[model samples]
Target chain A: MKAATPTGANIALFLAGLLFGLGLAVSGMINPAKVIGFLDLAGAWDPTLILVMGGGLALTLPAFHFILKRPAPLYGQKFHLPTLTQIDGKLIAGASLFGVGWGIAGFCPGPALAALVTLNSSVLLFVAAMLAGMALHRLLLE
Target chain B: MENFTPITGLIGGLLIGCAAVLTLWASGRIAGISGILSGLLFPHKTDTGWRALFIGGILIGAACFAWFNGGVTIEIQTSPGLTVIAGLLVGFGTRLGSGCTSGHGICGIGRLSRRSFTATATFMFVAIVTVYLTRHVLGGNL
Candidate 1:
């Protein structure tokens, strides 16, 4: 019930991100080949990624329920939840594009960020290009 | 499908869920990677600090894993040009769609958000078709 200070909140988020990255690495989710393997349903398909998703959901489901039942966060003032409930063109189109890109590169935001620690040129380039894309979207749409 | 480690995947996934839970419980924020990264690009005065910290923690955690757990492997078979293009598309699409796997798949799904469900289904279906077309129809070399 005690609200967190700004610094406390920041630290909490940092720890969360840290653990998330570590989990990504340990689970081999940072590996593009693994993701590709999962997507390769035609030949040598890997079902591990889906299992990972399953596991993540298994734990998140209960925890989220417990947290939401609380009046407020332990460190922050209020829950900043997503408000958009209606489906639309932008959501479908964007997700489709994202899925195609994910299929092509086998990288998403989380795994891509985790891969940055390797300092790989390809990873660096991907991150840079992704940031540019985000900027472009902001320029055109927002 | 060959290198599918269910236990490791589950453990790592649990860790990821724990991180998400902690972020929600402490900061009342959904640990959406694209959202976190996007907020960094389009900075608001109040939003800057935590986003940076969270990203920093991700990098630090990855570094720790690399140091302790041998290394993380990310095999990319696609050409460099294709990689950049994919990254761009991913960035643009995720932003336009408002979330990615972590947001829509994990957090949004956990929240039982109908829009997230639709988005997740769209992306999964498209990704499957894309992989099929690229690997089976297009000879698996892109």
Candidate 2:
């Protein structure tokens, strides 16, 4: 039988996700206009997102090292780290596709999910399409 | 656009980093939104519960932002059709790529993962190019 993940772990994950979404919202990342502004370098460039990305990196840099020093995670059996380290064609193609989408829509998975609270019609359409795409990937690729 | 707020951006990013660290410390999971959301759709026996809750938490957080943060302002300057296309591409690309901005850009780079660095560079480069083509060359308004 497969071991069940503890309920406490789920709760902790929920809380973490909540904080993450809240941070995205509070930082104006939920605004696609802001994202578009940042991408619009030739027009009126808004480099504030660089600061946001930088700030996230600054704190996480130290914290990750500290956490990795531990034997294992507090609640889980092991640190579920990514094993793939190669730079390949899939990575390049996928990144390019994602980048084009992001530039066109000004939303990624996190911010898009956070922006769902506003119930904008375009957001709804986009999310629906996104889910469909995921389903298609599952069907065709996996 | 005059809506850029760097201080809040930095603060929000730090909060996101904290959340990412907390998740890793507590669950040994990288706080990658695409991976988490995909897990829900794909369903792993040991992974389902936490995945559902994390996604739920994100929604709840969005609700809180809607309640206290003067509501989220979702401004998508593109047509519904274009938004849908972007969403589909994002979903497919992220899954194929195995990450996104948060996964590769933030957490992966923080760990000094070379794969993430390459992926990040690829995506950023493509996004910049796409934006330039759309905004400057094509005279498009997305």
| Per-candidate TM-score against the hidden true structure | 0.96, 0.96
For all candidates, the clash counts are 2, 0
Off by over 4 Å in 2: none
lDDT of candidate 1 over A1-142, digit per residue (tens): 3332478788899999899898898888899888888888887877888877887788788889888999998976689898887899999999999999898888999999999999999999889888988999999999
Candidate 1: pairs in clash: A4-A75, A46-B1
Candidate 1, DockQ score (0 to 1):
0.70
Instruction: Write candidate 2's Cα lDDT for A3-45 as tens digits.
Output: 6776667778889989888888888888887887888888788
Q: Where does candidate 1 chain B have its weakest 10-residue lDDT segment? A: B1-10
lDDT of 1 by residue, B42-136 (tens): 88776788889888888888888898988777787878898899899899999999999998998888878898899889888888888888888
Please tell me the TM-score of chain B in candidate 2 relative to the true structure's chain B: 0.92
Residue pairs in clash, model 2: none
